[model samples]
Target: MKITVTEDQAPLDYDQDQVAQQYQEAKQQLWRSRIEEPSLMRLIGDLRGKRVIDAACGEGYFTRRLRQAGAAEVVGFDISERMIELARSQEAHDPLGIAYRVEDARTVVPQQSFDLVVSAWLLVHAQTREELQEFCDGIASRLRPGGRFVTLTTNPDVYFFRPRPDYRKYGFEMTLAEHVKGGAPIRFTMHLEKADLEIVNYYLPLTEYQEAFRRAGFRDFQLHPLHLAPDPAGRDDRADWEDFLKNPIMILFDCVKAE
Candidate 1:
């Protein structure tokens, strides 16, 4: 007997459950490490008691952190329902009152503005600069006058220069150049582990990011360098650590609305 395969099958869209699981595993591997916690905690220290909007609060990793930092109110938004479900589950046990919702960061209109709006690695998955700009504008709109907005993104310099073996000889349908240049409006692809193997990430040009903040009404902006260690262990080699420190890896933009 011969079996026939159906042609009506459809490809699955983005799976929130799978994405949540990926985030859970990824955060455990990345954020749970001690090497990066100090920098993250130090950043959160200044946000204490502020009403915060966590624009892309995946799995509530940083949302819980914000609560621990004493944020008066923390509202989290994400496009993934499963992630939001997990976040909500996490919030139920917290002494701090944190709220998590499934919503698109691209179309954010908060009922009330916040004192600080913070997002981590949001633009990594976005397909266009326009999406990035819109995300920034959404954050700006959700902030009170003189409110602060911050984001952490991979540095483009590290990305565009890195070579991808998968694309080179594997016969991947699209080349890096085509992925970046062929898409309408010009887009970039995340090389993921191939580029920054340890972490799944994407990059945006430093200059373009600076200008994006300016366009979004952030009067002052700054990009701080983030250096990563190889073994997830504290750097013992001062020179290697120093070299990574000197090299641009990721950018953390801290800004405040001008108007």
Candidate 2:
């Protein structure tokens, strides 16, 4: 299936070097370093000898980690040219043997099937139902039968039901208009040390997400909550992380292609 975007449906750009750099830095922030990465890696457990694709792989951060986790082959794809360039530069510097390409997740043409397809913060970019379905279809096309797809995305429940300004403590803020529905635009701002980065994502109800997955031939879908990385000091609870835990901004979706 071919997925094309109309003029008004164009994707948000991270083609600027500064934006790409800020995005890479944002990954090192507490929420991502502690909650997102560890939980996502755990969900995608044991990739030894598997072929993996990191769709919408901004700067190839997780792509490198996927390779290190024993995937025989790993490829990173992103729509942003600057992001891909940064990822390729990192590969050149570290010699990870990973390949990086510029491609949109909603309309990607995979060269070969993969054992796993992983994305971080990709699905939220879909501005319409058709685009959301295209994203799912593109992912399904990249995977072999029974291959798994795992992604981290905005938790709609929290975004809609528990919207709050307290997220500033975690170095970011989310703003949404009242009575938001599917396809409503969401404003996400990251307060970095030196600068603030803002990006837009669209809201789609959970039901819509499930429908799209089914239409894309995925089954056994599951939603996994984010887990805070274990404290090195062996402390069970971290007071600072309590609010974020109660109202997590992100969650994981795990599903498999139907045979």
Candidate 3:
């Protein structure tokens, strides 16, 4: 699945047709609804009257959701053409005025600066610091000065991902080893049994992300680790909710581009 890269470019793994298809279907399932979407929506606040770029937006799931949630304008971009195609098809069936395009978040060519840019599960693929900064810079490039940016990312701490009964039942496992120090690269594998998919992500210290944000002229950064959203009173049968609090899978970032 490796593709030729320029001397300065980072390796990308999202362009595969099968991965794109699997991920598109995966997002529609219950895990996305209960686990990540609520936390993500809360972190981004009200999108009403704001133009938003759904960076690395897969299959336009959140893109359409943003529109339904009151965004004035929504545009979604992903590196995979297959993803964009699926998104476009969904948009065609039920047009939400969302525009889908193919573009890498690390090198996006935005049509116009956005009031807000939100990325979900996107930055973990950065294998190097420069790639991480490029992601931040690209986000900065797409935003108006003083624009807001929100992200859901892999928690860098790997101490919680050891083999466990819970992981197997959930159909995914994040395998980790000796932690690499000094912002060095640590490759982590997330194997999804349900999707029959395996995803590789980079694990770097949180300081590395802060530096990237600072270097990209982002300020007032706030990090919120993911927590389980409470269910309605009717659904009192909350199984496996405690694990989300104990070993939160993702961290949410709320940041602003410098004016």
Candidate 4:
């Protein structure tokens, strides 16, 4: 959907939503599990009987999951009208009691503060550190005092170190080994190699993120490397994956709003 923007504000185009949906559609994956399972499962497990907000919740796929996980109330907010429409359409059958709304991440005011807020892959494409801080401010604003915020983003170390290419390309041999991972064919084709596509990502260091959270009145924050080991002994060639888990392409932030 075309985002409405005034001269003073930047366009919060739902381009990310469209590209993500298109990629997922091409890959046939309903949601990204491998990347999401580690932190989300950890975050949701603590959310039973609590009010939860799924910020930047594209399509409400995981929003429905939050309801299933026993949240007292689940509200999924995204900036894309089409995404919200489609999410609602999918929930028309049983309606998992999750509400989906179209609202800008930077400006939308929550109906009420929530006990737990989770934003996934929303900060990866940020153009600068300030934008990431703005996102942090937004998350901080929607939390109840002493509430927790869980967000996932591209690993700054890995994102900054990835090789860059000057030309467009496609196709690569993926090994579940080394620092590189096989980009599984999902609704979209995300290559294992970084240089093939133009990625506008902010390499916001951990210290910078921590300071931003501090300024937002969040303390006692922890950064966990979002690395998952493949089923051990089940896959023989998984030793490389074990080592790769030391450093991953994603990072999860678990923080608490000061009381």
Candidate 5:
């Protein structure tokens, strides 16, 4: 029922059944272990009384987190059916009232729908600049005049294709065949349960994102580059955390719609 991705193949270049269990479990584990996840939470800020849409919400983790953080309303959606199924199932049992739907983030961007919109590592899927624009347009469309959209992304500066001591220290590797400015195929090798698996991503340049955000009517940007500064209160204490500071992994970006 599952197909595996070969070395010659793109990562996660498999059928839905694979993601149904194996890939998802690995991703979820990595989500907790990685430095980027906690950094994402810090970027999110206080959610009290805000209406949030968790675009590309995989497994509804953040959706429920948002609701628990006292968000006035929270809705989540994903393009993958299996991811949505897991999200909905979690919601049914936990009863967080977080709505989950199977829809691409670019579509169903209802006008003035939310006060804040967030996605976790969702921008890397835009393999083309045009697709990035459309995705930002959808995000902008869903926001009210003063709404903000935020997401975590791979640092465009780090050519993931090359080896990094930091990556190895963290127990995984990232590689790409070549560097393409606008978009390029990238892959993440995740080590889970002592086995290695790879997942595909796209290298989206910050410049491209700036242009897309501009076209989407976003007038301001706040990007938090990890590793430059230490958050005194941050709890993630991986052995390679210092190594992460040197090589840098990812960043969180926030863009605001003009009033």
Candidate 6:
């Protein structure tokens, strides 16, 4: 069955300066620092001399990391101009030779192919399978033959199969409609220290994600589980992370463009 997106299900905008700043702060949350970032960087191993694109690179967080990882060239793109402004400001303050641009991931026109393309929390915004396909296709277009695409996105299973408030302990909660299905809106509320941040993401079934990657000339599409980074303090916290580990809210998607 085809799922139709209503106006209320539209993707949230991060164009406002306040929204962009809040989002940047949200990225520093514990779960991201320990799980999401390490997991993604592990998947994108050895960036030395590689040309990379950080698609939907809000505030150039990962973009700067990519350059620091020794990527020969790195370009970051985000749909929000304010986000780009923040990224550019950082670039000015600390020159990493990274380029920032404002572009929608789904319709990005690739000027040149890259060795790798990484995006975090980008695909979940697709309101429909068609838009998801477009986003996949655009990512594929930006990669050279045999280049990889890695993204961190909402775990469909966590939303459709196990919607719960347990994640609130980890500083976020997902509110879902009683009748969940493809394209259903997912209200994600992040409990920050100062304020709560809410964003909308659409649920696309695993099969739909497979189809989108297959149709976009990608092969060996894989879903990778999150991994927690070692504690900097060397203190054991497995007990505290058990709930989150059992039901991870975000996961990594990895694939390679056909050579």
Clashes of each: 1, 0, 0, 7, 1, 0
lDDT of 4 by residue, 198-239 (tens): 223345567777887898789999876554434435665444
Error of 6 at 190 (Å): 1.2
What local lDDT does model 2 show for residue 141?
A: 87
**Residue range 1-259, candidate 1, lDDT tens digits:** 1111112322112243643564465465332343244455555457656899888887788888887778888999888778888888877766468888888877747635689888877765443568678877777778888888777655565435444223211111112233332111212222232221122333455666677778888887865545344454545654434433453344566888885
- Tens digit of lDDT per residue, candidate 6, span 127-164? 68889999998898889989999998888886645435
lDDT of each: 0.60, 0.84, 0.75, 0.62, 0.74, 0.85
TM-score of candidate 5 relative to the true fold: 0.85
Q: Please say which candidate is ahead in TM-score: 5 or 6.
A: 6
Runs of candidate 1 with Cα error greater than 4 angstroms are 1-14, 30-32, 108-111, 160-203, 227-248
| lDDT tens digits, residue span 112-211, model 2 | 5799999999998886789899999999989998999999988777555543647888888777756677777676778877887776778888888889
Worst 10 residues of 4 by lDDT: 180-189
Which 10 consecutive positions of candidate 6 have the poorest summed lDDT? 1-10
Give every collision pair in model 3: none
Question: Which has the higher lDDT value, candidate number 1 or candidate number 2?
Answer: 2
Model 5 lDDT on a 0 to 1 scale:
0.74
lDDT of 3 at 253: 86
Give a tens-digit lDDT track for model 5, residues 151-179.
97777767742444546646567676554
| lDDT of prediction 3 | 0.75
- For model 3, how does the per-residue alpha-carbon lDDT over 1-259 read when each residue is reduced to its tens digit? 3222232445435567767776665565445677789889988888879999999898888888899999999999988888898899999999889989989888845635799999888887787788898998888899998999999887876544554225544445555545554433333223333445555566767888998999988999898866456665557545666665566667888889998
Candidate 3 contains a number of clashing pairs equal to: 0
Query: What lDDT score is found at residue 92 in candidate 6?
Result: 100
Q: lDDT at 225 for candidate 2? A: 76
